[model samples]
Target chain A: MSKNEETEKSDVKDSTAAFEEALAKTKDKKYVLHLYVAGMGPKSIQAIDNIKRIFDEYLPGKYQLEVIDIYQNPVFAREGQIVAAPTLIKELPPPLRKLIGSMSDTERVLLGMDLISKPNENDEKQQE
Target chain B: MIEEKDRTLKEKSLEKAPTGINGLDDITYGGLPKGRTTLVYGSAGSGKTLMAMEFLVKGAQKYGEPGVFMAFEETAEDLAENFASLGFDLDGMESRDRLLVDHVHIDKSEIEETGEYDLEGLFIRLGLAIDSIGAKRVALDTLEVLFSGFQNEAILRSELRRLFRWLKDRGVTAIVTGERGEASLTRYGLEEYVADCVILLDNRMEEQISTRRLRIIKYRGSKHGTNEYPFLIEEDGISVLPITSLSLEHEVSTERISTGISRLDTMLGGQGYYRGTTVLVSGTAGTGKTSFAAQFCKAACERGERCLYFAFEESPDQITRNMKSIGIKLQPYLDSGLMQIHASRPMAYGLEMHLMGMRKILDTFNPDVIVIDPITNLISAGTEIDVKLMLTRLIDYLKLKNITAICTSLVQRESTEGINAQEISSLMDTWINLRFFESNNERNRGISVVKARGMAHSNQIREYMLTNHGIEIRDVYLGPSGGLLMGSSRDIQEAKETAEIAAQSKNAARRKRELESKLKSLDAQITALNSEFEVQKEELDKLSSEEALRSNALAKDRSEMARIRRADLH
Candidate 1:
């Protein structure tokens, strides 16, 4: 990765450790997430499935997920400032984060949600 | 499928949506394309966002077409606050369901792109906003911000193309603004997507002065003005000036108005300037150009017509006071609301601002006559071409409205004969040239008509005075040196002419008396000669009688001998 990404990685590493310590002290820390999608498209389905599976494996009943279809509830799109469909917004856990595209990349999702600090091999591919 | 047939059937005639901005519709032949996307790209602070918003606001307010403004840069509250000063009630429009504003905030630092995605959420929000208000017009102010929010260029590009097609399919006229690029029309090449029409706004600085210009780069299925027109952004809105009225086909009126001075009127074809014509009064410094314009303004007001005066060099108080010195009382007309005076320094703003301000005044005042005193001061605001272009459009507009206009120009003393107000002189209908006559060690003012279209005007240069009463045009006076005389020199010439007439009459009377005396002497001498002839005749007659008597006595003696002589005679 470039210099900025490396520095950002080190910063994320420092913050992730502090967040994990707080989570351990609480022992009941919950993640609040809102996924905005358009109707029943394939990307929306894939995103819903991928995020649910990750939450089950890691969060394990310690999270709340609201799947909003902008086609039916278009008002949420404006409120969430969503341009691309299948966008995941972590509204809880202090610092807010927005992840665009389907939740197909688990490492990026975890990094975006502050679950992990280190980036996967995908960072090298992006740099190339 | 039915819409495809409908479009094909009406492809020959493209309908338009009239942008209520001043002077923009005239150059666009009407306005922007209806149910089409127009790409407006410009550099930073070039007024692209303002122009697009004005288009939407004017459409909603004037055309009764509800609009949706999807701002990608400024927030909804900020946009409303910024436009509040321009008299646009955005908050009120939203309440009345006439307009809708949706700000799409996207921060690059907060976004993390992972995998495949499509911009379907934007379409949903935009569709919801439009359907809520039945909006016919939409504005996407700087949509290129989405490029930074999303990392995939291919997805962004395809999504933009789909968005424009979607806007067209919905039959909503849209304006998409983009930041100007170095080698292309937009930073992200947005022009390639929204290709139905494109407009470019530019703000250029020359000689430490800034001017805003707008040009239509392309307009499909329509003809538009190709020149870069100067535009102004005032407290109200943007106004583009369509310079160079394309034709000389404006209608002419036969009505005549007085020039306030009867002698000057007589010199100008025994009437005055035409009712809806432009009169150029050109002269050097202190040659009475302003005074001449004031006289015309007074005349226009005397006929119960409203007159607007634009003074570039003098203040309203100064003009009124100076005019009072020449017996023109403008205070009453001002109080009665028949006259208005707008005075400002020529360098107070750019030439476009001046023109736009004057246009606004013309709208509010609706004066029948306008006077621009000393247009030479405007030269400091811009170049010669700029001034000329501005004046041409101004004169053309005034004529079209049937408003009589008088423009005064100041020329240099040495170059007045050749220059004569430079390029602006040819655009005038009647050109009155005031000059200074330097002779006999004194300077005086003389006035003449250089050219007066459609009238018989005087060719003689008459000396005019700004006396205590008003302007007075004197008769042509020829000096002894065979040139036009003025001032004290004219007075001296008049006196000398009067003395010459008296001397010629006196000499003729003297010769007549001398001839009368000679006739009396000749008559007396003829009488004396006649008396002498009669006396000599009487003496001769008396002598002849005496000789006759003596001859008779001798005949008596000779009678006796005559008898014998008589017999020989028989």
Candidate 2:
């Protein structure tokens, strides 16, 4: 191929990659979140901590988390319809999901967030 | 554009909250449709605050629906304390995050809303509180306090409408309490029209008797109890006794109880009275009306049944002492918890207040038999019609509970000839008459069984005596004498006099019988002499015949000679 033709083709490829990146960014899954706390208390702190840990672990690259304190920001807590302490809402996913209690169960949290598929006994047996 | 979609989506997603008040729920049917606003309007001390707090507390505790209470009249602490007396643990609920109590101290002078400002500020605060606990119920206790801060009715009216709209938009069941206006429900007159339901509470006194009544003025999409139901507020909260339509299907008890007097019981068809019956004993003054009622109470207590004696004429101590003279000791029964003596003057308070007091005491005591001595005294507090209506309501109430009630009425001396109190006679299960009669120049008391429902009672009037021992009913005394004495003492005197006269006449007859026996002996002697004289005459005649025979023989000889001569001649 001619050197000029090669350069143009490369340029076209670059433009196409840039367009695709833009499209991907536009269509990137949002992290719709809900935080439920019962007023300002230590238990609320623990719930926020556990949710932050889970978000960092499974959705580090692409996720937006909204912190909802029922006491200081009760309006959002009511709007999100939080009834109990330490409730998490995942809104970014096509279908919204909720995780109640302190997000201690990593597998359950990941499953609730649709980050990982449920593990199978056969896969574990093969690994063993 | 996004806000519009969000708004539609929110409207579609909201769910209704349930309030557990009985009649109130019936009016609103399934409760204020989850997130709608209901206005409760009433005058001062009309139970608006208490009702609002009750709704909020009930929602949080009963239905797992958290609630927010915003009070403009009372401070948060004061409201909590007031509810605490009613056994509502507002502080505990607050601690559990199930309830939020906010005392919005609105100084009308400080607030300045000149232009169109979104009540979002107030909505945001309410939303924050509701969102904090996901409260499903909200109560704004007394909007009038806030409206009072504003001068212009137009501004207040529009603001109230917007507030109600905002609450409806949020899909939260809200109760707005308001102070009653002189002419309308609220001074602004906007809440009654805008709200989905309106309830009016009234505290009124008739003839000095005070009663709390509740009424539902308007409900949009549901049917409700339209009558004003009597309610009471105590330590437990508010209770409304909805008057059920009178039907003849109420259960009747055939059990009989003694009237404490055997003769009286015999007059009542060999049984005292039917259970759950009302007996009215009416008569002139000093005719043993109170004694008869006391006897009933005594009999009831003896049967191990509790009795409540409401004496409007006499005090408890005086009644107890008076009953003691008639051989009925009520003090021991009172001490044993089997009898309660409630004594209050007729004019001590208004008639409705008295009724309320009686109702309160009845509820607390729950007696099997209730005795009101001299119900006529209650008339002093109200008009004749008021007394009749009050008694009617009281009778209906007591009958509904299946309680045996006895009411005594005092009739004027002359009025006893006619219906003593015609208004109450038809309602009474039994009527007993006690009267004063004069016989043989003496005063006496007579008791007659006039009428007893479902029982055959004696028609003859019986004499009764009140002695230190007890009331003694005597039998009918049939005497040949023209006049009869009524009092026991006079009857005893007449019997003595009649006995003395009969004893003297019997003695004179005994003497006459002795004289007659002597006369018969003398007459027998005279008859014997006459028989001897006759025998003598017969013997003389015989002698005369012999002599005559001799003479005749002689005469015959002579005559024969003469006859021979005569024969020869013939």
Candidate 3:
């Protein structure tokens, strides 16, 4: 029984190592995001929570999110060209993209970042 | 809800923040409300930015209050250059920590709004500036640029309300300038938010004359002037004119001043015009209205009192040249700075604007007397009501300050006979009408005092004569038929009267000579008669002597009988 338990523990450790290696490899494609917000109004808090949820569910531990309150850090706000609060900026990506509004529409946010494909009708329009 | 709070706050405090603008303090009683926001809205080039800048600069310099100017449209350097001519120490004040200027460079194309946001960054910046300088006043030169750049207007509105409230809480008087709207007071209708006070500025052109007008639309819990006041943006800054006093409670004087021509002075109330009264010199063209006014100005200047001559039809050099012909030495006064001759065409500005310019001159020069050479020239610039209203206000203000004014009005030749004094009677405290009377194929000048409010003036028409010395008023010459005569007819009548006097004196001399001759002849006749009688008496005496000798013997006897008869007769 001790040998079998040791074998199980070793298998679990191997699986954890494999998972770490996979995470490290996926980190190369990680998303670096900044959510600029005014104080925590309903929409600002919602946007922060929504973007966090989308990143956690889709990319797991591959994304780094920095939340900045414009009221507290106005310098950052000015330097980032953040005119409105609850703004999401994909900072590290070569094609930097900005998403404005409450993050209620996950599909649209993904489409703005080119993370998703539209339905068949969009493809037909592109072909034309 | 904001209005209610503003009203309550105003009533509780009754505090004021003085704006060191010319004549604006008097109109606002003290100034804008203390620790409250004022909305200043105006069209382009209406001096809005200049006015706001002046407010801040003056606040720091004169009121002992530091100010912060946050401009969204103009850069700090641009502002500094714009106000350099006004001689404001903007850079000095900024260096001394009394003034802080922030320019928010905004480009609409560059701005990208993504979500809900407040203008908290601006608030923080303004707060930091205020905190650094311990500012007591704050001004946002223009908010239109922000509006144009920002996409979420709802957020901006909320932020504006919050910002104003924050300013109130910060205990700083604030001025927020905005672009004018088509129908509303401000482009964004922000007047509804800043409810403490709203001032509207307008720049309009009438007949190629540009006039800048300022009017206070709302001043909660305070009584303010409702009329549009004229303001000037000059080298010294914005100067608002106090043309009309809201009240008629001005002190009046009973003192008098000469009208320059001693004869005309005598005709005016037997003394002259009241020292602080307004006189209207109305006449037909070429009847010497300007000459009349020039004489007054000369007399006033000669009295060691300052005088201002505003000539509309002639240039200053022209006026001086023309006046020199009448023995009025205006150049000396000009050199001595006692007399200011400001010559501008009546079409240079609107009537009210002219009054404002006059008011500014009045304040700067502080002249004891003012002469408007031909106030009628302003008629071509505005309606009669406009001219009359401006004149009324001008006169009213002059009277309030105890400054004498002499205004000339030209009447059309075919208008009326005696005087067109009824046209502006309400505005004139004294009216002197000058007319050109045609008599015996010659034109003669006449002056008659139509009205003198507080004193009795001459009712007879005196002929006005302008010579190398000055004006001279002559009494009328009465012809043989009791007809009033002037010009060559007057000379003719005087000659006739002289001839008649000579003829009468000659006749009296002839009659006296005749009477003396007749007396001498009668004396001769009496002497001759006396001689004849004497001769007769001598003959009788000789005869009587002969008879006496013959009767000498009989006399003794007759004497006895005569003695007895005499004794009986005794």
Candidate 4:
């Protein structure tokens, strides 16, 4: 387990160093979140994977994610009074938010998590 | 799994969960309504939580049904430790997956309530726990404080309502405890919302002594006792004395046991007290209340049945020492484990406490007969109503158990009255009153049957002496009037009666001799009159013959007519 930790730590160091090189190229906002699930069921795992894939593709090392299983540590959900899981609690970028239900829906999850906004049809028409 | 008969018995389209407390099941006919929440509201220290916890623990252990306990007031560890004295190993049950203790912590300081929230988290956690163990019973201990302390009242009430409905839908027997309200069942007055059954617990102090009482306020579809039953919360958990609500369906016994004294037994309808009946030995001081009670205990022990003697006025040693003088050896019975003497001052505890203590001993010792010496002194602990209620409950319990009980009460020596005229007597099946009869300037013990139900007991008040042979029934001598005679007066009266009877017989003999002489003289006079009648007949015969001869001589001469006439006359 210690070796695994060491390898993961070195991998994080490499990713951070590369991200620093790329961050000098573009400007983006950091994303911080906490995801609560019932247990490591297939749906929960899928939700975790979907969110992680989205984060990796869009935010890269700019985001921090913490996943908690309500089955194992229900205290978080109890303390937060979270109604449902897989719930994504956004605790960054000024306003706290909650995105409940399946996280597999990327567009809805992004919109609900304040990652994206609906485009205005009139503005698009005016642009065209 | 439900049995066929039980399902048919409660065939009200609703399942029932049995709470395995003694006498409790009998009152509920089984237990609380199943698959629904039961509201158990009570004041502080009323054993509401204990009742709920016992329901869960007993359901898990005895009925083979797993349970989940959601304790809101006390933490899981503290609850576990508190219930450990009841011999419930919560940790063990948890390890077995038969129980789950979830402590829902709701500290307002640690909470950040910013937006709309629900106990959806609680529902989720509780649902998951119940599913994990396949639980059948659920207990939410002290839920009132948690909800009232929550920031949002509407959310709390709505969520609690939803929680109860969810539990009902999930098919779990749930118990929800609440703090007693001044004018309502629960502090929130939410009793009208959910729950198929409601029970109320009361812990009150009367005259500086405390008592715990339980009552079943409502059961939706079942028959239940409505009496305020006395309950005790000890190391063994909560025990409700539902026996007070028995329906007189207890079977009676025709068997009669002795009263250690043969004479006393004879006085009790030629046999003794009826088995399973309550007998009251009411008397004044020095009227041998304890002595008579000891005789009964000894008799019970002699039959190899356990007897419990509650001596409120005398210590067990003192009773033993005092009874030994009356030839009642209680030590032997105590040694043989057939007798137990529980002595406590009546002033030491209230009437309810005394009742619970007796009930506690009743359960532990399982005595066949119980003797309570001087129950009158318990009057000091409570009102007359309280004492009467306490004794009625106790007697009801004993009768329901088919346990014969003897109770002694001390009245004023001069008055020799009851606690209430005919109050205790009417409640008892037999009432024997002993009084000190002052005769010839000496006090004598006289016992009489005030009332013995369904039996013909002697109405004569017999003066008895308590010697080393116990109580001896002496033949009562009636005084010149109607009073009972005893002591030297009785001896003197007996001797005088003998002398009077002898003198009266002698006078009767002399009168009989004089009447016989009078009869002899009358018979002699009748015999003399018979002899004179015989002599007169013979003289008449001689006179008639001489006249006939003279008439015949005259007839031969001048006038034979006279002779013929005389001959004709002859």
Candidate 5:
């Protein structure tokens, strides 16, 4: 847990430079993410690994991720209103978002994190 | 619920965890099966959330059993604020460690499920909450929300099954709610998973009026009420009415009470209505139904017993003022707190709501007798069948409490016999029917006892007037045609009867005088005959004397001789 906290603190500090340079752009915005899980379950580990791999490939050292084990810190579970394990909350973006389940699908995770915009034409087609 | 716990244990039968909800425990026989998960499903606005919350609240406050409310749709704060109006101190219960409210936020719009994930977080949170308060009751309101949050239906189903088992294994009674579906009790068929008990709530609209009904679809291994019972979402909380046909097991009393009208009492077997029995006073409009009911209440208050008056048409002040004209002093009883007058327009609420409101008042007032003035006005609240059902329940409740009930009903037509009273007359112990007699260009009121159980009551229809002094029940007057007469017609008939009797007596006196005069004339004729006979005898004697004088000289001797010869002095 301490190691995870150190990496989270360092990542925020490291992303501050790009945040200052590209203040108006959405690309270089510092991402603060909270991943709530239930103990050291297999899904929790897989979710952590999957999101880390995505962070390394897309915005390395530009995101801060803190994994919360709701079993150990149940208060956070209530405060966060977490119902499903492996829930990821993106707090830094203008519009907050919450994504649940294993973070294996990189495209959906990116879409959920506001790293990519939704395809509006597909949405309209579905509506039609 | 509290009364049957020891019995259930002694009988080695299914134990129950009482929900403490009004009328719910009674219908469930005891309560929901203990340490089991019961599913409650309903459509939106059908009061599923409120019912589930009440179970927890009541368990915590009344049963000394801490509860955990794990809401899947609403936030804890929202739930607390929502129920605050219902007098449920959710936040207070939480602060006092008697209750724990956990909201599991599920947003389908924000979730993406890529791989396998169990609902272990919800389980852990629930467990932690339970452990914190040692909760004996748990409420997972609308747990079906997990279906929307997760894409794996199979996983959700399996986890739900396992969650119910866990709840049972922990020996904590739990209530799981689901959204109603077109084909099943719930959209996701949650009833299939938590199948120990299932209750369905339905809100139906008929004639632009809405009524909430509850039904126990199944209670595994336990006997329960299977009929759809009308329930009300009252000011305080939900109250289910289990007022079906209860067994005829209520205790009976031989005690009788007065009807306030002495002659009316004479009409009711000369002893009035039996204690703890139902009396119905039915009549046409302006036949004094309200006055009859008020007199009953006055009589109760005079006995120093509490009375509750439910006036569906008139305001309390109006009734008090109107009754004052009839010389019934209701104000003193009201002031002394022996009588409570609750007046409301029947159309203001549904039948179930009115029943529940009356029930609440009944509990608080705990009166010995109750008067429902103009109960026919309640027909505006529901249909005839609904009104009948509502009154049945009310009467059953009153009987159980040994509370004598006098209900007044207004008949639409004088010839039809009060339809409202007729519908419920079978449940009443005594029925007093008042009708308007239209005769002599005037309308008069007549009261009669149509039926009184367990007593020989007068079947005669007596005319009653709402005099300034009070209700005066007059002697029954029979017309020449043997029909009941009233008002000016009765007075006219009585006067004519008296005149005929007087004429008969006068003719008898004239015959007696004529017979006396005939007897006096017959006596005078006999006296005259006697006098004439005496004169004849005197004349004969004078002739004989003259003859005798002519021959006097010789006759002196002859007379003596004749006298001697004529008669021997013997």
Candidate 6:
């Protein structure tokens, strides 16, 4: 009976460690988001579409993406809160961020999203 | 239902709504009780509508409380346009949802009331408007207009009571505008009795000048200013100036301001009138009273002290030209913004309104000297007593501010000499009387310093000449003759004539003395001659006796020397 109680105590300690690790991850990694649009018109439609595409590109596995129509919501349109039709929100990642205009600037978007490190000389040359 | 113990334990709380007007809030302690109805009753053109609208707009703009205005006399658009000149941006406020304006059209010809009909229609409209914008202030622009449409006073009275009670129940401050009755505070005395607060506005014209006065007759559960307040409707909206409480603690200034004329200043204690002193220049017409006041304003402007000229009779341009003719040179001062001329006919408005406008200008300009050219013009706008009270209040106000004030009064010859004069001469610290006298078949202007408080003034009357170069006050023409036209030349001529007459008299007296002395000497000479003759005769006789012998001879001389000599003579 004493041996059985010791095994139960060890199982309890493992489960507690796993629970603490999950809590630590949630506390450290903050959700990051970005919305882009061309203008207040419907052509900016696919900008949100493209952002959802990017969300499907890398962050689709575990992130949340929101589509905003700047024309209908003009209050958020002028500030570049949205620059392109498609925008992505990496809600699962830490420290929120944004990318504006066309999603063609993917590396910049990735950099803005903190998905990549500071670009090297070669990366800069490639971007140019 | 609560029992007696529960009722005793309940807390009594009262809410107050503030009227965002300067000095008015202090007069009303805190403000009118919230959710209570206030009746603002006034005669025609007494600024009732203006006052009510101002209260609502001020509440909405200054206190962040939305307001609802219901007008029965004028449409909302017309009302807005009317107030546009007064700088009230009602449209902007309405766009911001801070104010709601509802116009109710009541046709007097078609309205009929029977039995008990609820005023629920008005309530519903007001409620909808208030609810739409969450208004905290409400104004019914003229409840009397509603009464005109219906002849039933009993129904109207009950409806009004219900309206007040309903407003109170709604917990919103309301202002109900009403027309003043011919002999009562309000046309329907019922409104006055029902209102928690009652205000009366009066518009009267005396001597053709119009004035507006506001008085708070009753304020329940609050301390309010009891005296009548003066209000003005101008480009900047309506302003109500509560009368300043009379306090003896107001500080006095020892500073003095020049009276333009050096001789006049010298007569005023060698300095000038004391600061804040009310100087009165009173006289019959054509006394240059207005000119004297203008001279002071001109001097003040030249000294870099701002001055305001309030001309009730003359247009500003006319006054400027007149002053220029007198060599006053007010143009330069006006160009420099040192002098401001406000010209208006006293009959253009009511007396209280004029007073209010004067107060407002004084407040805005903060002038060092305020000159009212012939304040007597205001008499046309009010009764004698009203004018006196207004002048008294105005003088008191000026004294409180320590501003030098000059007021002129035009007195007719008969009035000035009459026992009951219409002029405000008693309230002046300095009274200067101007008069015209006929002398030498010519009209002459004379000014005399009647009284100067705290100073000794010349008792002599000075002759003033209005010339191209301004007023020239010649030396007191101290001629032997009383007429003003007896200039110095006349005095000299009189002196020379007297001297010649005295010389003639002296010569005549000398001649008389000479004649008398000559007579006396002649008489003595005669007596002496007689004595000599007698003595000679006696001697002759003696000699003759001695020479009787010899003589008879002398035959006596008949000669007795023939007599001798002729007694010679013979």
Which candidate number maximizes lDDT? Answer: 1
Best by TM-score: 1
- What is the lDDT, from 0 to 100, of the residue B73 in candidate 2? 82
Highest DockQ, which number?
Answer: 1
Q: All models, DockQ values?
A: 0.65, 0.02, 0.16, 0.07, 0.48, 0.01
* Cα lDDT tens digits for candidate 1, B148-186: 788888898888889999999999999988888888667
TM-score of chain B of 6: 0.71
Candidate 3 share of real interface contacts = 0.24
lDDT of 5 by residue, B1-570 (tens): 866987778777678999898889989988888889998888899998999899999998889999999887888899999999999999999999999998777878777766667777788788889999999999988866766778888888888788889889988999988888889667767655466999989999877678899999999889888888888988789888887647679899999999988888888788888999998888878999888888888888999999999988889999999999999989999999999999998889898888888988999999999988777777788877777888888899899899999888777778634354537878888888888888778998888888889998997888999998789998778987999989988888888889989999999889888888888888888899889988998999988997788678685776678787996533
Candidate 4: stretches off by over 4 Å: A1-128, B1-12, B300-305, B349-353, B363-368, B378-386, B413-422, B498-570
Q: Is candidate 2 or candidate 4 better by DockQ?
A: 4
Quote the B-chain TM-score, candidate 5: 0.87
Backbone clashes per model, in order? 0, 17, 0, 1, 0, 46
C-alpha RMSD over true interface residues, each candidate: 0.8, 17.4, 3.9, 7.6, 1.4, 28.6
Question: For model 3, how does the per-residue alpha-carbon lDDT over B1-570 read when each residue is reduced to its tens digit?
Answer: 999999998779668889999867778888888888888888889988887888888888899999999888888898888778789878888999989888875666443444455565577667777887899999997878766777777877877778779988998998888888878666667655565888888887765666678998888767778888777776688877656654578899988999999988788777889998989898888888888898998999889999999889999999888889988768999999999999898876677667777887898999899998877787776666556666777777888889988989887762345445336666788988888788678998888888889887877878878887778887678767876677888878788888989999999999999999999999999999999999999999999999998899787777788787785532
Which residue pairs overlap in candidate 3's backbone? Answer: none
For candidate 1, the TM-score is: 0.90
Measured on C-alpha atoms, candidate 6 has an lDDT of 0.73
lDDT of 3 at B335: 94
- Residue B196, candidate 6: C-alpha displacement in angstroms: 0.8
Write down the worst ten-residue block by lDDT for model 3 chain B. B414-423
Ranking of all predicted structures according to TM-score, beginning with the best and ending with the worst? 1, 5, 3, 4, 2, 6
- With candidate 3 superimposed using the best TM-score fit, by how many Å does residue B420's alpha carbon deviate from the native? 5.6
DockQ of 2: 0.02
Instruction: Assign candidate 3 its CAPRI class.
Output: incorrect
lDDT (Cα, tens digit) per residue for candidate 4, span B184-301: 6776678645778888999888777777788888888778888887777766777776644556677888888777778777888888888999988888778898998888888888
Give a tens-digit lDDT track for model 3, residues A54-122.
878877887889988877876675566554557778886546777766777787677765566566897
lDDT of 2: 0.76
